[model samples]
Target chain A: MRVDVRALGACNRLAERGAERAADALADLTGTDLAVEVTGASVASGEDLAEAFAGRESIGVSVGLDGGLDGEAVLAFDSQQADALLSLLPGGASMGRSAVTEVGNIALGGFLDGWANYLGQAIDMTPPRYFEADGAAVLPDGALAGDGVFLFESRLDATTTDLDFSIYMLPDSGPFRDLVVGKTATAATPGAEGAAEGTGDAGSTVVPYESLSTFASLAKRGSTNAADNIGMMTGLDTTVEVSRLRFVPLADVPAEVGVEPHAGTVFELQGEPSGYLAILFEEESAAAVAASMLPTEPDDPLGDMAENALCELGNVMTSGFIDGWANVLGTSIAHSPPEFVHDIGSATISPIVAELGRRQDYGFVIDAAIQTEGVQAQCDVYALPDERELAAALSRLSET
Target chain B: MSHPSSAGGRDASGSARRVAVGVGDLAVVDGDAALTTSGLGSCVAVALVDPTTGARGLLHAMLPSADDSQSSRPSARPAKYVDSGVDALIDELGAAGASPNRLEARLVGGAEMLDLTAAVGPRNVERAERALADAGIPIVARDVGDGVGRTVRYRPNGELAVRAADGFERTL
Candidate 1:
């Protein structure tokens, strides 16, 4: 099944609209002005999702949907904000979890209206389930560990108060897959027609949504290869810690990489889906890793010999990284000679972002973190592919 | 005095309230608060200050022009491009009780941190300069166009500090 390139974007709009209505409903219930800060749909592993909420304590309510769409929705606020919201209710501090649950039920009603309206059907929702615990525990037990799921997340902030809320929608795999792959069917569903009309761009390429997951797995394989190459060259035990795909605005790339000084190598990929790849290491980690590859300890860890050693390592890792995609595409992918760079983390990234920004607004960043066991060495790998080309390549995958 | 406003956070160097401008974002502040942004490479951060009213605005722009990028989204951020970002900063500072005639621009960032074929740092700097000149704002101070990333802190009192990754710090 082929999916329109605009399918994901249309889904993002639906998520944003739902969040906006939910914010309004919450405002009316609590008389506190609220604004939808940001909303998007991302594909990530349950482990990564759980890791995102590891530290914060949150309170909110969750509900399951049965009709029109099959999935679960969660509305939560930080513990401090929950306390402030509790004081706003009629029962004040006495209402506690029930008050939050009631608000969740109402706000969720507003959230589902967008999806139901678009689907041209009625959706049934289960009773609200109140939760007060660590943010990770709030998700359903099945969503805490293994497979990747398509998640819609929206954040809302109160304009006049220091409170914020996050809404997470986890649609069951079947419905979510059908939503994106709808266009390929001879008979288009109401939801698919709406998505096509919402984008107003029909000439673009379409690929099966399932191919996205396939590509994500390809990223996981690339990281594993890089880890093996690191272990071989440095004689250090290396493991792939985090591997995930992030879809974000090209403009946000620099800030997301952050402000720390880094030492690394950059390469430009040349193939079906031409793109860029960067292997960045913390300053100290770069020094240590570079030294490990050399027979003798160099006077300056980052000197010419160390730089050359690092470059060779990056060369082999780059080949190992893109080899998977090449095999999947049935075409060879070549990369430029590694360019050694030492600068602030974001600085090394923004140049590539600007280059990609010339033709694309959003990027699918395949990122992975590799760490040396019992050592301070950590390497961050980022691969950004041209969206149009990627869609074309993935469409070929569905054909095969 | 610690006002503890929701819009501000603890400054990295002191107790003063600070608003951080992210990539392709902008902020305007009143009174004695600080506006800061970090890890600027090819992106340019422009600060427009009106010393008379102590009102200031900062813009962190990633590209030279909006035409250079393909953004199909409806809410294309104005601060993502140098020309539009400068215009937005000027309008915001004006709304914050700062007179347009008295605005002075201080520029930081725009570094070619990597030797890529299509260098954008110089183009971003050039565009920012032209944008400010067209807005009739004087270029009072600037730290631009090098091979290093920089962090910037701008105060309403016309103090701008630039810190590079190589331990170089200067006040403009």
Candidate 2:
């Protein structure tokens, strides 16, 4: 089914219902919900919600929620976890595609299916897509409106591993529902004023999920999170899938100009003159990736194909990370293109090397290991921080 | 199993032990040989240890070389910037006759924070590589670059185990 105007209206009401249902579901899933005192919860980032999966890696059945906002869901499982989750299935990764997609299809199906049955509203859902990483840059645009976005999140500890999902909804305030239900009295005359009145506050226009509690006046639960309804949890929501976006371009460089002094460059944090840092993969991995890419190896090559792939892979992932940071924080930043290096001799590295070695100023560091179809990539991210935001990230649990 | 810490013994004759330091800011000692440094990322860390005395040191760098010179002690600040940090390390080790020939090294970090068209992570990592190559020390082991931030540790005696995105740590 597709999302139509009437269907959109129904989806909106169902999403409203979800808010109320989410709070209760969370209280039940967390077991410690009574201790889970709802903080003011004025704001939360997609990253904060995503990071919830750190260290707890055996998560299968990835789920993505692309509703009325630019938010996503990611659930990854290790190979063993994937195998067990897809028990009695066919062969390897390829054979498991349908089985994995089924997980998301079922999870989403449960939500919409239950909503349609309970509210008797005609809400439709799109087929779930597989996500390797949290696609912050590719999130549906123009999905949100107004100010005061609210972010609500909950975690569930299932039989073996844990499961979690965040529902990001925007409150498009209007008097339509009230007018339709209240003014449509028997023998009552129609009034244009009643229908035209609007909650025109700019904040009221684009309410974020985190700020939903503030908009409790307008926003309500959209669908009930199937916490108490464990019977409905029969839907699938676990699997591991991988997608690699590689740019294959064949370019030749002069043999004389072989040294690419600036081949692998990454992150550019903002400071006075300039501030930046990048890690260069040792020569072996560069050679490994090159061996996989090239048919023949030449002496003193212009640039190793493996190094190029490795660096560019870093570039894409880091670029995507920057975009994710900007989108979630609703901020903007500039960065340099990535460069690669081979046979870079070892040297002692110091923290002060980047920030000029002063503890007075320190940046946040993120170390992650990324595994694609045939490549293993490692990268780090740093973001300078101060008070409020710092506290939040330190408090973030942001991957799932 | 982890390597045994043989960084015992104090200042010795010309015989200095080999050391590969990890991520962190502290001096490591293995007999008389000593190296000091930090890893790089959007955040930087340095490692330092002595081979003759089995001492080492490191510091992870974050900002550029200039910011570190903001107000730190002239000598104390050199080991902070990539350019001067290496110089300071060499000079400090030189006090014990640690020559370029006897000195062997390994480095890590300098992962970027943002990946704009002209980010700084690559630049910093590049400069560190260039500076070290010019200094004549072959990099024994390193897990650095565009991918992920690493918490690299150094072993002054054997090889430093690098634990990061990849589960198994390797000695470099």
Candidate 3:
């Protein structure tokens, strides 16, 4: 075969959430669930190859019959898609074909397996073909003469990686079973054209992730237990972990955010840029947790169980930031807390919020991940910069 | 990744022009056109355009080539990996009137998303640059293989500027 060489990489990224995201993106794009096939590929260059330079890469691919989906085809992406897949990688403007190769070797394997199983077919695939060019050129020019095509494209908002896949197939599928059948198969059948595409969080993803600020005046009593109160209001399981919640001067935090909590009964800490948390459990855990907390009956949309957990989680966590902050600033300010957002891209949680609150003179931001019994939750809290109070606090923050 | 910000706040002229790339994203600019992208970290970015057509192309890659033992799974999207993704970008540029022999190449990205544990970044950079070179396309300039992430931009004529950034930015 006339293979065009681009870059090469081993499947070292096949671990933890890195592996899961690859699997999920694959399933979301190809309509099939995937499992990891542990294998390794080593590289030749280390000294010159150690850095993020051009003209070098290392990633691998292997094919097998998970015997599930009807048809399976992998479409390796360029860095453009890699840009979309990794939360930290930026847009396509900077990367090369190598990044896409890694995405292809590691992430594409999961997607292919997922789609093959989704189609309920024993999928036999060729060894991967790597090169330097746009992916569309290698479309089954001759092989797809009779097969219809299922072009699935997915994006990872965090990595800016693109998991774009196209399966050349016959319109009708002869089932062989072994797919994700049972319940999820029926639900995930994306009945439409063959353009099977969507991030794992595509469904119900339109839930607006707007960054908002609500103002609340401190109550007369100091021990209002507002953070815990938010837990009650939202009805879910949550915790308030504080490394150092002591009352201190306002100048401790970064100056870019102008808000000096010391002026308002709130202290601050060393938050570099932003931070995050992970949220995941399952439905049973959610029900148990909800049963113990929510005053209302916990019988709603099964999916909402996680949402409930997340809302309270958001409320409680932000309340922690508020409580700790209030002590630092030495003022009692009320809070209009953050709403919980579920099925979110864990990587983009901060970027989305930072994108929104970048210009605002906010006091603090608490990025939280509420793991429910089943569904995942990503919630964040942006301390609305109190303008009048902050004007006074800046002078204090600046004075050594 | 470099180029901490994808869309830089408007310059005094309010004209958005520069070589800033996003992850898994691309920009097509005419010969006289200008484009910019965010930097890349471990991800590898490939840029190839026809000087005659001014058809600019850029692809950020993550792994190496699609044919390597590391990339034997044929069910992957070709554009999703360095091996295949670079192919996808080359195909795109070719369609835009870029002759394979006439295509110029530049690379960025492939940062160490993790610490010093793998060769994904280097592999990506090496594969893409080598492939284009093997095809007789010259890589005029490149900024690849930095432990930190980068943001890169490219002018259709292959004028690129890159910035390095730490921390992270969610995909756009």
All candidates: TM-score: 0.76, 0.31, 0.33
The candidates score, on chain A by TM-score, as follows 0.70, 0.29, 0.26
State which docking tier applies to candidate 2. Answer: incorrect
Ranking of all predicted structures according to lDDT, beginning with the best and ending with the worst: 1, 3, 2
Question: Candidate 1 on B29-123: residue-level lDDT in tens?
Answer: 88767888888888899988888888888898888998676644323467878988888888887878999999988888888877754779989
Which candidate number has the best lDDT?
1
Candidate achieving higher DockQ, 1 or 2: 1
Candidate 2: tens digits of C-alpha lDDT, residues A255-340: 01111222234445442213443443334444443344345774533365555655654455444544444444434534566644
Name the lDDT value of residue A54 in candidate 3.
Answer: 33
Q: Per-residue error at A224 for model 2, in Å?
A: 26
For candidate 1, lDDT tens digit of each residue in A271-312? 878888888887888898787778899999788988898898
Candidate with maximal DockQ: 1
What's the CA error at residue B19 for candidate 3, in Å? 9.5
- In order, the TM-score of chain B in each prediction is 0.90, 0.61, 0.72
iRMSD values, candidates in order: 5.5, 19.0, 16.6
Docking class of 1: acceptable
| Candidates in descending TM-score order | 1, 3, 2
Candidate 3 per-residue lDDT, tens place, B1-109, comes to 1111233233223554444334434545554445654424455778777777678877754446545522122422344356666667777677667788778777766
lDDT (10s digit) by residue, model 3, range A1-400: 0000000010111111233456566545434434322211111111211221233332223232233443433443343434444433333425544444544655656545554443455455445555533333333232223221212222222222223332222111123111111222223333311112122222311111110001111111111353455456655434432111111111111111111110001112122212222222233433444454555656663346546554464345445554544554454544343333221121112222222112221133222233333334332222324232433332332233
Cα displacement (Å) at residue A159, model 2? 38
Cα distance off (Å), candidate 3, residue A297: 48
